[model samples]
Target: MKRPNGEKNISSTITLYADDGREFKQTFTIPLKANTPPPKPGYAVAKTTGTPAYYVLCITVPDMDKTAGEGFA
Candidate 1:
């Protein structure tokens, strides 16, 4: 999915297929801003001042066993 130019935020849904024929899905939104810090272990700041600008979208997925297999396991 691609964010249109000048949009304030972008969002998309992601789906993951497990080995046991189960599927997990989640939607995420990322805001576009300047002078903001990126996630840990990131490449560059999100459009920081006086630096080369880069847009970053970080997605954090929880432990799969706890999220995908809640009670079915």
Candidate 2:
């Protein structure tokens, strides 16, 4: 999931599962280095602090977009 800072696009596929044991796959694209904001259901960059710094991918889920909700991973 590593890309150059000057890269212009990010694409990836994600899999999700339901409580009933059903699975789904979705492909998404996010534009980079654009004047306007990226589209919804994109991702944000985060950093971790410690001996070695690492980047984290914080994805945005449209269905889970709420002000108050419990988080689970």
Candidate 3:
């Protein structure tokens, strides 16, 4: 759910700065799509080095799904 400020409940806004000291705040929204069955509940964000990585390496699942529990919806 989004908060009053339009920020997602699971995340918060943060300021990012470049090496040049330029700072900016960006609003990002994560999508939920599972191609394979979840192994466990919770989520993960994998970091990669080089070539501006961060291309499709994350997980977002409810606690129940991560713990082998049934999802309510």
Task: Identify the candidate with maximal lDDT.
Answer: 2
lDDT of 1: 0.50
What do the candidate models score in CA lDDT, each in turn?
0.50, 0.64, 0.55
**Lowest lDDT 10-mer window, candidate 3?**
2-11
Per-model TM-score, in order, reads 0.22, 0.31, 0.21
What lDDT tens digits, residue by residue, belong to model 2 across residues 1-73? 8754445444445567889988766644544353444346878999999769999999986655445545642
Clashing residue pairs found in predicted model 3: 40-66, 41-66
Kindly report which residue stretches of model 1 are placed more than 4 angstroms away from their true locations once superposed: 1-4, 25-73
lDDT of 2 at 28: 44
Better of 1 and 2 by lDDT: 2
Structural RMSD, model 2? 12.2
State residue 64's C-alpha deviation in candidate 3, in Å: 18
Candidate 3 lDDT tens digits, 1-73: 4334333334445567889998766855555344444346555667777787765556665554344346454
Pairs with backbone N, CA or C atoms under 3 Å apart (clashes), candidate 1: none
Cα lDDT tens digits, model 1, 7-67, are 4343444666789978767544555443433334533335545557666665453332354
The residue ranges of model 3 lying beyond 4 angstroms of the native Cα positions read: 1-8, 29-73
Q: Which of candidates 2 and 3 is the stronger one according to lDDT?
A: 2
Evaluate candidate 3 by giving its C-alpha RMSD to the native, one decimal. 15.8
